[model samples]
Target: MTTGQMARAAEAPYYYVPPHSIYPIRGSLSMLATLLGAALWVNDFTVGPYLCIAGIISMLVTLYGWFGDAIGESEGGLNSKRIDVSYRWSMTWFIFSEVMFFSAFFGALWYTREVSTPWLSTLDSQTLLWPGFAGTWPNLGPAGTIAPFKTVSPFWLPTINTALLLSSAAAVTVAHHALRAANRSRTIFWLGLGILLGFAFVACQAYEYHEAYTELNLRFTSGAFGALFFMLTGFHGFHVIIGATVLSVIWWRVVRGDFTATHHFGFEGAAWYWHFVDVVWLGLYVFVYWM
Candidate 1:
C-alpha cells in the first residue's frame, strides 16, 4: 500500500471493530460496586470492602482484555506515524486539562490566602458587609474551627520526606540520561533507586499525617488552614502515588525491553509526570508547608 493509504487506513483503527458490549452497563455496575465500597469504607460497613474488591477486579479484567486487544493491534503493524502523532496530541491535551484542573484548586487557595482575607478585613465603609468577621487565610471560619489548627513541624520527618523526594527525582533524571546513553545497567540501577526513594517518600508522608492528626491537631475540620493544607498536600500526595505507579510500570516494561533511546515514549511520558509531581511538591513545600 502507498504510505498515504496506509496512513489513512491506520487512522480508522476503531472503525473496523464490531460493537460487542454496552459500556453503560459495565460502567454502571462497576460504579455501583465502587460506590458501595466507598460508602462502606466511610461508614465502616462490612460489605463495602467486598463490593469495592469485586468492582476493582472486574474493571481490571476489562482493562486487561481491552488493552490486550490494543497491544495485539499495535504489534500487528496497524499503527502508523500519523496515529502516533495523534496519540501524542491527545495525551498532551489530556495533561493540559489536568494541569488546569489543578490550577483551579491552586487559584482558590491563593485567593483565600492573599486577596480574600485582606478584603474581608478591609476597614472600608463596606466593612459592615462582614460585621465582626475576622479575616484569615490558612485559619478560616469561626474563631478557631471545627477542631483546631496546629502548624505542622517541617523540622523532622517532613524534612526527611522532602529530601527523599528530591533525591528520587534526581535519581530518575540520572536514569533518564543513562537511558539516553543506552547504558542499560546504570539506567536500571538508577530507576530502581528512584522507585525505592519514591516509596520512602510516601511512607514518610503517611507518618507525617499521623503525627499531624494525632498530636498536632492539624486536620481538615480546622477551616481554611487545614482545608488548604490537606487539599494541596493531599492531592500532591495522590499525584505521587500515581507517579510511583507509572514508574513501576515503566520499570517492568524496561525489563521486558519495551523501551529504547528512539522509542521510549512511555518512559518519557511517565518521567514528565513524575518530574511535574516533584515540581509541584517543591512549590507546596515552600508555599504550603513552609511559607
Candidate 2:
C-alpha cells in the first residue's frame, strides 16, 4: 500500500456514520399521545389527563436517552468537520423555519386589521348584516357575544418583559464571547444570568396574562383582538420557555467541561435559538403592544 494510504488507515475513520435509531418513531408516538390526550382532556374525558401525563413523561424520557447518545457520540470524537458543518446548516434552516412560522401569524394580524376590517366597514350590507356594528379594530362581533374586554397596553409588564428579554440576549451574547475566548467560568456565569433573565420574562408574562384575564376581561374568546393577542404572545412565551430550557442544558454541559473554544456547536445552537426568541419578542412588543 502507499505510505499515505497506510497512514490514513492507521488513523480513525474520517467520517462517523450513525446507526439507524427508533428515536423518531418514539418521539412521534409520544407527540400523538400528548395531542390526543390534550384534545380528550379539553373535552372532559376521564382518562385524558392521565394519558397526557404519561405521554409527557415518555417524551421526556426519550429525549433524555436520545441526548445522552448524542453527547456520547460528540465527546467520543465521532463527529468530523463535515458533521459539524452539517449541524450548523441544520440549525440555520431550523431557525429560518421558525421565522416563517411567526411571519404567518403576523401576516394574519395585519390582514385582519388593515384589510378585512376596512373592507367590511365600507360594505353597504354591513349595516343590515349587523346593526350598530362598527368595523373598528378590536371589535366584539356584531351580535355582542363577546364581553367588553380591554386591550393590554404597552406600559408596565410588557415593557418589563421586553427589557428582560433584551437583557437576556445581551447576556447570552456575552456568554458566547466568553466561551469563544476559552473562559469557561465567565461563560457559565453569564449563561446562568441569561437563564435567570429568561425565567423573569416568563414570570412577567404570566402576571400580564393574569391581569388581562382577571382585571381587563381580555381572553382567548373575547374577539379577533383577543385571539390574536393571546395566540401571538402565548406562542412566543412557549418559545421562551423552550429556549430557557435549552440554555440551561447547555450551561450544565459547560459546567461539565463538555465544550471548548473551537468545538462547541451545541452551545452555539442553543444561543442562536435564544437570540431568535429575543428577536421575536421584540417584534411582538412593537406590533402587538405598541401598535
Candidate 3:
C-alpha cells in the first residue's frame, strides 16, 4: 500500500465490536415463546393468546434495545468507512435472501397453477382417484371440500395500493436526492411523505382484508389460492411496516443532523430496503392480484 493510504488506514477508527450481551438469547427465547404460544392457541389453549402477546412484547423490547445500541454507536461516530461498507454488504445479502424467500412462494403459486393442477386433472387420476375435478387455475378440491369463495381482484383497493407504493418509491428517491444535496428540510419532507404513504397503504390493505373476509368470503382457509394470497400479501405488508419503521428512524436521525451530504449510509440503507419492498409489492400486484 502507498504511504499516505497506510497512514490513513492506521488512523481510521478501529472496528467497533459490541460487548457480549443477552439480547440474542432474549430474542430467541421470545420467538420460542411466540411459536409455542401459537401452537397452543391453535389447539384452543386458554393461556396461549396471553403468552403470545407477552412474547411479542418481549421481542419488541429486545429489538428496541438492540437497535438502539447500534444507533447510539453510529451517532457517536464510532462507525468507520469500513463499518459502513460492511453494513451495505449486509443489507444487500439480506435483501437477496428475502428475494429467494418470496421466489419460493411464487414458485409454489406457479407450479400449482401451471403444472400440478393440470397434471392432476389427467385421465387416470380424474376418473379413478378423483372424479369431476376440473383442471382450473384454482381448483376447489374435488368439489364440496372447500367452501365457495371469491378471489381478490386487482380492483380499486389493490390498484390504489399499487399507486401508494409507487408514489412512496418516488418520494423516497426524491428524499435520497435531497439528502445527497445536504438539504435536511427537503429530505425530511419527502421522507415523511414516503412514510405517510406507506402507512396509508397499510391502512388500505387492512380495509381490503376486512372486505375480503366480510364480503368476499376469502380467507386463509379458503384454498390454495387463499393460502398463497394471504402468504404473499401478508408477508409483503409486514415488510412494508418494517421498511417504514426503518425510514422513520432515519428521518428522525436526519432531523437531528446525524448525517451529512457524504456520510448517510443509514438513510441509504433504509431507502434500499424501502425500494426492495416497493419492488416486491409490484411483483405481488402483477402475480397475486392481476394474474
Candidate 4:
C-alpha cells in the first residue's frame, strides 16, 4: 500500500458511522418554509418573498454546516472505503433523480407541442369557444388575452452559452485526468478555468433573460411557448448555478490538498454533477432553442 493509504487505514475504522445530527430535520423544515413561501408568493401574499428568502438562507446555512462536518470527517480519516462507496452510490442516485426531473419538463414540452396543440386545432369546440382561434404551438389565446411576443432565436447568446458549457466540460475532464496523474497545478488551472466558464455561461443566460423581457417582450405569461421557454431554460440555468457552486467548493478543497489520486470521491462527485448539467444544457439547447 502507498503511504497515504497506509496512514488512512491505520487512522480510520473499518466502517465509521457518524453520531445523530439535526441536519435532516433542519433541511426538511427549511424546504417546507420555502415551499410555503412560494405558495403564498404565487398567491400575492405580502410576506411571501421575505419568508422565501429567509428559508433559502436557512437552507444554505444548513447545507454549509452539514457538508462542512462531512468534510471534516473525511479529512480526519473517519471515512473508510465503505463510506466512499456509499457516497458514490448516493451521488449516482442523486444525478439519476435530476435526470428524471428534467425529463418531466421535456415531456411536458412534447405533449404541449405535438399532442395537445395539434389536437386542439382539430377540436370542434375551438370554433364554438373562440372563432378563428388557431391552435398553434404559440397560440396567443383568444385575441387580446396574451400580448404578442417574439420567440427567442438561437443566435449569438444561446449559441455562445452552449459553447461555453461544452468547453467547460472538456476542461473539467482534463482536470480530472490531471488529478489522476497527480498534477495538482494542472488540475487547479483547468478546474478553475472550467468554473469560470460555467459562471460566464450563467452571466450570458442572465443577459439573455434581460433581453427577452425588455426587447422581445417574452415572459412567463406571454403564451404557452413563453412559459415553457422560461421554465426549461430557467430551471436549467438554476442547475448550472448549483453545479458551478459545487465545483467551486471542490476547487477550494483541491487547492487545500483535500484529495489524493485514488481517493477523490468528492471531486468525482462534483465532476459528475457538472457533466450532468452540461448534458442537460445540450438537451435544452436542442429542444428549446433549435426545435
Candidate 5:
C-alpha cells in the first residue's frame, strides 16, 4: 500500500478488527498470583515464594507473547500515525494521573510535617501519661536503642544515589535527543549508560535499606519516618525499574529499525515517562528524605 493508504488503514476504527484478546486476562492472572505471593511471603508464609516465582515467569511469558505481536504489527506498517497519536494521548493521560497520585502523597507529607506532628508532640495529656514520649517522625523505643535504631541521615549514600539518579536522567535525555537525530550508536550508548545508572541507584537503595533495618532499626512498622520513607522511595524504585525497562525496549527497537527520526512517539513517550519518574524522585528526596 502507498504510505497514505497505509496511514488511512491504520486510522480505521479498532472496532473493525473486533477487540478480542486473551493476553490481558492471562496477564492479570499472573499479576494476581504474584501479588498474593508477595503478600504471603511478607507474612512469612511457606508457599508464597514458590508461587511468586511461578507467577513472575508466567507474567514474563505473557509479556513476551503480547509484545511480540505488537512489534510484528508495528513493523509491518499496520500501526500508522493515528495509532501513534492515540498512544501519545494515552501515555500523557496516564502520566498525568500518576502525577496527581504522587501529589496527594506529597500533600499528606506536608500536612504531617507542618501541622500534625507538632500538634501531636505538644499534647500535655500524652506527655503527662506516657512520660518517655520522644515526639519524632521515627520514634525510637527502649530509651537508648543504640546504633541499629538510630534515624537515617540523608548525608551519605542517599545523597550519592540522588546524584546517580539525576545523572541517569540527564543521560536518558541525551539518548532521547540522539534518537531524534537518528544517531543510533549515540542513542544506544546513552540509553545503556542510563540503564546502568538506574541499576546503581537500585543497588544503593538495597544497601541503604539493609543498613536501615539491621544497623539503624528503621522499618515500615517503625513510625512515621519509616512509613514515609518506604512508601515514597519504594514506589520510586518501582518506577525506576519500569523506566529502565522502557529504555531497554527503546534500545532494542532501535536495533530493529522500529522507529524513525520523523515518527517515534513510542520512544519519546517512554523517555518522557522516565523523565517524569526522575522528577518525582527529586521531589521524594527533598520532601521525604532531606526535609
Candidate 6:
C-alpha cells in the first residue's frame, strides 16, 4: 500500500483524546440562567419565567450538540476499550453523587418528622413560645400561621404512577435483553414502550400536583410538610423527565443503528440511569407517599 494509504489505515490511539469544546461553558451558563430565573420568578419578578424558558432551551441545545459529538466519536471508532472503561467509571460516580443528593433531602424529611417537630412541641417553653401548637406530622405551624392543607394520599394516582414507572423499568430491561440478543426490532419496540410509560408517569404526577394545589390547597409555602413534600417529589419529577429525555435520545440512536450487541455502552449507561431513577421512585413511594 502507498505510504498515505498506510497512514490512513492506522489504528486509533490507545486512549481517545477529545478536543476542547464550548459545551461545558454553555451548559454552565444555561444552568446559571435557570437558577437565577427561578429565584427571581419565585420572588415575583416579571421577566423570570421567560429567562427560565430561555435557559432550558439553551441547555437542551447544548446537550444535543454535546451528545452528537460523543455519538460521532463512538461511531467513528475513536473510542477504545480504555475510553469505554473511563465512561463507565464516570457514570458510576455520577450516579453515586445523585444518591447522596437524594439522601440529603430524605434525611431532612426524616429529621423534621422524627426529631425536630416532636422536640419543638415537647419543649416546656412551648406554652409561652407558641400557644395552641400541636406536634403533628403535618403541622400547619403554631397559631395557624400556615393555611390548613391536606397531605396527599398514595391510594390511586401515586399508586398508578408507581406501577407505570415499574412497568417502564421492566420494559427497559426487556429492551436491554433484546439488544443483547441482536433483536433490533424488539429492542426498538420495548424502548419506545418504556419511553411512553415514562411520559405517562410524568402526566400522572402533573395531575397529582394540580390536585394538591387546586383541590387540597397545598402549596410550597404550606409549612415544613409542604416544603419537604414539594422538594422531594418535585426533584424526583425533574429526574423522571430527564431520564425520559435520555431514553428518547438513546431510542433515536438505536433507530439509527448506533449500537451493536457487543458494543453499546451508550445504551447501557442510559439503562443504568433509568434503573437508578426507578429505584429512587420506589423509595419515594414508600417513604414520601405511603408513609
Candidate 3 structure lDDT? 0.88
Any idea how many clashes model 2 has?
A: 0
The predictions' CA RMSDs to the true structure, in order, are 4.7, 4.0, 3.6, 2.1, 3.2, 3.5
Model 6: per-residue Cα lDDT at residue 116: 80
Error of 2 at 215 (Å): 0.4
- As for lDDT, the candidate ahead, 1 or 5, is 5
> Per-residue CA lDDT of candidate 5, range 1-291, in tens?
246645655675652232477999999999999999989998999999999999999999999888788666665566656676767899999999999988877887787767766665665835654455555654553253423356668888888988998899899889888988989889889988998998899889899889988887788866556677788888888888878887888778887777767657768888888889888988987777667
Clashing pairs in 1: 138-225, 140-224
Off by over 4 Å in 5: 1-19, 124-132, 141-148
Question: lDDT scores for all predictions?
Answer: 0.75, 0.89, 0.88, 0.89, 0.78, 0.89
Candidate 2 lDDT? 0.89
Task: Show where candidate 1 strays beyond 4 Å.
Answer: 1-53, 123-132
lDDT tens readout by residue for model 6, 97-202:
9999999999999999899888778667486677667888889898889998998999999899999999999999999999999999999999999999999999
Candidate 6 residues lying further than 4 Å off, grouped into runs, are: 1-13
Hey, what RMSD does candidate 2 come out at? Answer: 4.0
Instruction: Return the top candidate by TM-score.
Output: 4
When sorted by lDDT, best at the front, the candidate numbers are 6, 4, 2, 3, 5, 1
Estimate, for each residue in 155-262, the C-alpha lDDT of model 3 and write its tens digit.
889999999999999999999999999899999999999999999999999999999999998899988899999999999999999999988888898898877777
Q: How close is candidate 1 to the true structure, as a TM-score?
A: 0.79
The regions of model 2 sitting more than 4 angstroms off are 1-13
Better candidate by TM-score, 1 or 3 = 3
